[model samples]
Target: MRAGTLIATDSGNTLAAVRRCEGSLERMRGLLWRPALVPGQGLLIAPCNSVHTIGMRYAIDVVFLDRDGRVLKVCPALKPLRMAMARGARQVIELAAGEASRLGLLPKRVVRWQETLTA
Candidate 1:
């Protein structure tokens, strides 16, 4: 699926908007020069297990997910110049600070894109 907002159907946790980073170059430059992440805005990097905030300008919340979109872990308020990892994560989501808690994005929670009905 093309990149979009991923909402938790069961818990109503909304992950704002999302930008995809799949290729090596895209993944490597994930959120590097962004000034800030608005609430509900995030970066989704696929096939990633670890991430570093070496050049990030602000802190963010991180959600690690498996291939099936089940959350593997959640790291809140991860500051810049830091790093984190999830052993079995196939995707990593980076969100604005506190967005994770507000959305109740917890481990095992399944996240998916909302389907919009056609006219």
Candidate 2:
């Protein structure tokens, strides 16, 4: 999901929005490893191919997406010191942990990515 917004749904309604990252080494290094206060419609474009060793004050749900923005893997409540790997993922989105379960996101579930007017 190249530099786009990730809309998580709960009960068929949008619950949270997370910026999609390409998971490049440069992008990963550029991103703040701390908890971020992103507003509604916020987005963080990443340059890498995956995210690793995320250290934040709170746990977050991670969604691994393929080149087509398809949901490849979902790791709910990913706590600090925990690691999630996306073998076939081209991008990874970090959302508030447990958001995945609340959104009923599971393997094989397809996530749709809509391009915003602004980056």
- Judging by lDDT against the true structure, name the best candidate: 1
The C-alpha RMSD in Å for every predicted model, in order, reads 2.7, 4.5
User: Which ten residues in a row are the worst by lDDT in model 2?
Assistant: 39-48
Give the runs in model 1 whose Cα sits over 4 Å from its true position. Answer: 11-14, 114-119
Per-residue CA lDDT of candidate 2, range 1-119, in tens?
34444454323444346454445554555335644434333233332345554555555567777766567887776676667778878666666555667666677666655554663
RMSD of 2: 4.5
lDDT of each: 0.83, 0.56
TM-score against truth, every candidate: 0.86, 0.64
Candidate 2 wrongly placed segments (more than 4 Å) = 1-15, 21-26, 29-49
Candidate 1: 10-residue stretch with minimal lDDT: 110-119
On TM-score, the candidate that comes out on top is 1
Per-residue lDDT, model 2, residue 46, is 36
Cα lDDT of model 1 by residue, 11-103, tens digit:
676657777775898888888886788887788888899999998778999999998889999999999899999998999989999988988
